[model samples]
Target: MSKLLKFSAETGEKFLTYSLVSVGLGTVIAQVAPHVWFLDNYAGLFQLYKKGFAVEVPSHFETMLSEISDDLAIPVKNPLTRLLTVIGFDTMHFGTTSTTSGCFIGIPVNFNYKSEKDIDKLSIQVGNKSVPWDSKDGIELANSLILSDAAKRFGIAYELSLVDTFKFYLHCFSGPVIVIICGGVNNYFCNIFGLPYRPFPVKGVFYGLLIAFGIGFYYLSKDLITTYYEMQALKNVSKVGEEYITGGLEFYDKLLARNKALRNLLPDGSSEFNTDGDSIYLFRKKHVPITVKKQLLEKELEKLNHSNII
Candidate 1:
């Protein structure tokens, strides 16, 4: 019997360790693989390029001002363009560039609209470097800035719109996706050679299938091995608690029974019985009186209350 008990204990420990190892390995693989392959390096590069392009509008503005001033003697140098350029350069150095910069920079500058009737009244402050220009004539100024006659003829708003769209895709989405795909493929290949891992041609499909199977097993009648053990431990503790409660109740019930028996033995009209706090066993005679019968009942009640019966 002792040998059987020892063998069972050893087997249980080994099984528990194996289960822990499997769960630990699976969790580490799932969490680390995705971030290392697709999320970190690829996402990081996309963010860097976006930051580099965040001050693209300000740069474009500077170029337009330089070109327009050269042709029309307007002296349109924008201080805002210099500040934005410095900010963009600093962000690129820090490696903290992302899509958020575009929103922050673009939204502030484009907040107000240019009214058609008040085009002459609209003036943009470039910086201390250049004079503010009437925004009503911004299209013509933009056109003058362009080197290509065809491009200049099309108007500044058209050119700016096209440039803005191109920058958005290059900085925000396309650049990031391309970088992510390249890094993911490279990492996947590296993992095959470096780790105890094999290459899967249809990894996405297989991963989906594995996840579905795991979920089904967790939800369906199949064993929830870890949860089952936890429940079993709780059940054991509940059983111990119930035993203690039952034992306490049984003791209380026996005490009540003994008290009732003592009350029955007491004389109905006796002075001892009439008073609440009086001990019926205290009135002792050399010969057992009818009151002595009550004393014996009291003694039995005390014994039952003190003894472990249940």
Candidate 2:
């Protein structure tokens, strides 16, 4: 029985060690070569290319890129920040350009949907929440969501600002950090209370409690970090110019409007989204509330207007 207890302790230690090592390796891969796992569809690496979704990069998008780069003094040039058009509802940036390998930003095809056929294509794509409407209504809905040039620029700048930060790297390390801290705490408790030599039931409960605590801590910490950086990015991008300031406000307003439309259109509208159009999460949220985003930008716009008058 003594020999079995010793073996059990050793086995548990080995398992923890292996888990930590694997997570550390995964963190490294995610930071350096994220494309290995993420955006496979965007890269067309697996399965047949999604039809009618992959469109050529728009000419004006290039102009927006150049303008934003010049205004923000960020190097999001070709090869460093590759842009791809894919079928989706949102325009988003992936990975970071800080790595030698570069990163990608995806422009959703739905943003440019104009025709009846385009609306049909959008209806079938995944992640779409809109209820089926007539072709005329669909075109109107799509057009309503279509952002103006200034709003689009602000959106792109916001995305660029996020990728250009250490948020991604911090996100990668968050898991490992939580593991190391939790592991240390676990060890400390086990040694202090003689947990290892305790009966199986006691050990099981103790370890289970630690695992639960670790998961909670990890999410709370990550969400707080995400919220902080998201706000910081908003503030940073708002400083670019007055148009960007107004543009940022318009961007959030339009998004909220879109969400409101979706909430009415989706089957589970009231349950899935709040009246304000933000998705209602079960536990916690990683992104700032759209209402809050609009409020911040509105304040900035008011300040700019007052200053102009002065």
Candidate 3:
């Protein structure tokens, strides 16, 4: 039994330690490692991008989206590319050398894109360093940031419309989903939500949110596991508790019987004991009362089989 308890304690401690360490590591990585953040939350970013590009707009993004859509809506490149890409951005090169900078909300952005293997591995480079066109990790990271940033600016540049509102919702959603695609969620949402228009670093928000989420999840799960174990342990000891209660009742009944037998011998069958506080005292004819405390009775019963009470 001692060995079993030792093992259970060790296991519980280890589980708690592991959970804490994992959450702490995840938070540290999310904060210091931008690439990891991007990879973890890319799914949410993709969803936001889809919402951003679909809204009707008159900005440069709209023009780009339109041309890209036309080329993609009916794929002339391949039967597979019909609904997605007009020309694969993988091979497409853009530079600020009079060929790549595009106007975004009147802001000229150095948007350049390249892909390797296929569209799934497309990379976008802004200025001299975005991500290499061939680096899959770099490309994925860029794709998340670029698409999110572009869509947000496009929403801002265009008139008040469904797109802007959607962008706000996207920002709210993005605040917590920082683990995926390092950066980019809802720039529009962030601006409006923060109001008064202060500059909010998206990456900083991402890291903080990631850390908060990791810690929250770890503690929540640990508490749940601990509760479950406590319940199970109680269930295992239920029989012992029951035995203790039964033993106590039997001891009381025997004591009462013994007292009654003693009194019956007195001809009048009178009681000879009285309860006083936590003690029981016996009355002796022409002598001082002898006393036995309730605790002593319980202790005597307990000594008979210590395990049951335990």
Which of the numbered candidates is closest to the native, going by highest TM-score? Answer: 2
TM-score per candidate: 0.17, 0.86, 0.18
Residue 85 in model 2: lDDT: 72
lDDT of 1 at 39: 35
Q: What's each prediction's clash count?
A: 3, 0, 11
Give the runs in model 2 whose Cα sits over 4 Å from its true position.
27-53, 113-140
Residues 216-237 of candidate 2 have per-residue lDDT tens digits of 8878877888888889888888
Candidate 2 has an lDDT of 0.72
Q: Which is better, 1 or 2, measured by TM-score?
A: 2
Error of 3 at 224 (Å): 0.7
Whole-model Cα lDDT per candidate? 0.32, 0.72, 0.32
Q: How displaced is residue 195 in candidate 1, in Å?
A: 7.2
